[model samples]
Target: MAEDSGAEKTEQPTPKKLQDAAEKGQIARSKDLGTAFVLIGSAAALLVFGKMLAMAVLTIGQRMLRLDEKDIFETNSMFTAWGDAGGELIMPLIGIFSLILIAAFLGNTLLGGFNLSWQAAGPKASKMDPLKGLKRMFGLQALVELGKSFLKVAVVVGVAFFLLKLFFMDIMALSLMSEPNNIESALYFLGWLFLGLCASTSLIAIVDAPYQKWNHVRQLKMSLQEIKDEHKNSEGSPEIKARIRRTQMQMSMKRMMQQVPTADVIVTNPTHYAVALKYDQGKFRAPVVVAKGVDDIAMHIRKIANGHKIPVIESPALARSIYYTTKLDHPIPEQLFAAVAQVLAYVFQLRLYRKGKGSRPKNLAKELPIPDEFKH
Candidate 1:
């Protein structure tokens, strides 16, 4: 979609879109904010480490000045003296530079967070297009950057002039101070100057940072069609989901029917409902419903039971009770235990009779003791 159509982008960018953009390294960041942070950090480092650094420099300079003419004249002595001076300054310089580097890292990552994407750094054919390059050079972003540069120059110069005027007397007094005092006072005054510049840059950063974030989000605003397409791709369309659900239900029903032959007995509501149950003395505390159904499904269960020679009992109330109160593959409710036990007992007797080991048992009682809660 053409991003030029502002009216079409009524919806905010989804989290997936934002994450995709971030992965591509298209994150919102303000260079001005980073610059401000670095400047302020540098200023702070200077304030904290300036005395130690100055002492190191002074020590090095004094050592060099005190070098004997013989040492200066000899190649080995000259090299040795220079090496010692360098060693004297290394620790203080490392301390100051390490702090500055840390500040720079924090400044760059503060708004957009740290992201390392090779795609952003890689070369692209699109980036080489002459027309696109020209367009970008003359774009609104270019104009904004140009205006920002001017504003920063104006603010820095203005602040510097103000600070100089405010500290005119103190600065002039530095001229009257002698040798080491003059250098120390000058370093102190320079620290204040750095702080003032940092403050001015921070003000510009404060304004620019919010604008950068808002502009980034505005660019990523999504159209309604785009959101719908994203949703369809991520979660699938409603018709496909419904079809998947239907297939799952069919598979589940087929699995339920397969357990029908394993049932000890089938209790039917004559025509409307059927429940198949299994019980084992050691395996279950009570009979469990292995399969159940209604109407046409009930007829299918009865047919399967008859083929397997599993006893089928016509008991409407008991069938309804087990069907309503028990889940497939789960034990019957405690309240239905006595009623299911009676049914199982009769099934056992019928099996023994068919084997010619005992006399045929009487049919199960019609009015089995079903709990009122499971009456339906």
Candidate 2:
């Protein structure tokens, strides 16, 4: 009921809302996740393929320095040397680039699955509005981003400081040692440095992913009115739906009453129930209940029957059974066949006698032989 303002966005996003947002390319994504992915991927690619690439570089250098006089003089040999150098670099470059591309793709998919949207790539005028940009730059998101940057810087700087302090004496001792020892020490330092960087970024990613998700959800929260409007759009508004139902019921009631005047007889519970029956030997094998009603509707049926001079039979059990068991335009069950047949026979006899063409029929069955089960 408190759906007054867009300000009260208290509802979590619905699936349809999320889907629509995705189509517009609105997704929760963290630059830190992508950065972490790229760093890890590049480090892995370089480590796995560094030896082969180093050998290729060494081979190129050797070829360049040791070229024969004939090779330098021939333009074709010169071109061949250049082609060999390019070929050597191509595989390593491709592998590294592919790793970066895969890292970016995976980072995005971690947040919102494999969603593709060109709309996100399109330019917008809002991006160029300096005031809007300034406002965003000073917004809570910007402050959060700034805090993340500071945290990253602090961790990296602190890790570097500690690593340097631990290695200060060993680094100085490197100068006094042989080349291989110094090289080994340097490699160990590089390994530790890479580990520290990876550790810091992994921590950042752990925090950033959830923050991005929460921020995205907060941005997309819906007001109560929005939820109601969405429901109305999906399933008609309640008021309109109720009105439609009422109109349909009235139309159905009118149609049922229209058939009452043509009924052969109106059976009743005398006060509580009524069932109008009609039979035609040519169009039907047995009697059909044209309509049925109770209470106010029963009284209305009696009034209409009286106006039309149609017979109204006060048989509580038959009326209750017909009202309960039979439907409009459908034949009564076989269980009621004998009972209905007797009523039809008496009506036929009474009609013929009224025209003075025959003698009055003997007393009709007082109870109409209604079944025990149908009696209630």
Question: If scored against the real structure, what TM-score would every candidate get?
Answer: 0.90, 0.64
lDDT of each: 0.89, 0.82
Query: Which stretches of candidate 1 lie above 4 Å from their native place?
Result: 1-7, 68-87, 116-123, 172-175
Q: Which stretches of candidate 2 lie over 4 Å from their true place?
A: 1-26, 52-98, 112-129, 157-199, 220-238, 254-272, 276-290, 295-314, 326-373
Give the alpha carbon lDDT tens digit for every residue of 302-325 in model 1.
Answer: 999999988899899999988988
Report model 1's TM-score to 2 decimal places.
Answer: 0.90
Worst 10 residues of 1 by lDDT: 1-10
List the RMSD of every prediction in angstroms. Answer: 2.8, 6.2
For model 2, what is the C-alpha lDDT against the true structure? 0.82
Clash count (model 2, backbone only): 0
Residue 58, model 1: lDDT of 79
lDDT of 2 by residue, 1-376 (tens): 4437635899999888998899889988888887888777766666555555666676787788886879868879978989999989888778868877898788768886777888878888888999999999999889999999999998778877887888788778878976445555555555556656665787789899999999999989998788888888889988989999999999999999999999988988899999899999999888998888999999999999999988888778788888878888899998999988877777778778888988898765658777788777
Candidate 1 lDDT score relative to the true structure = 0.89
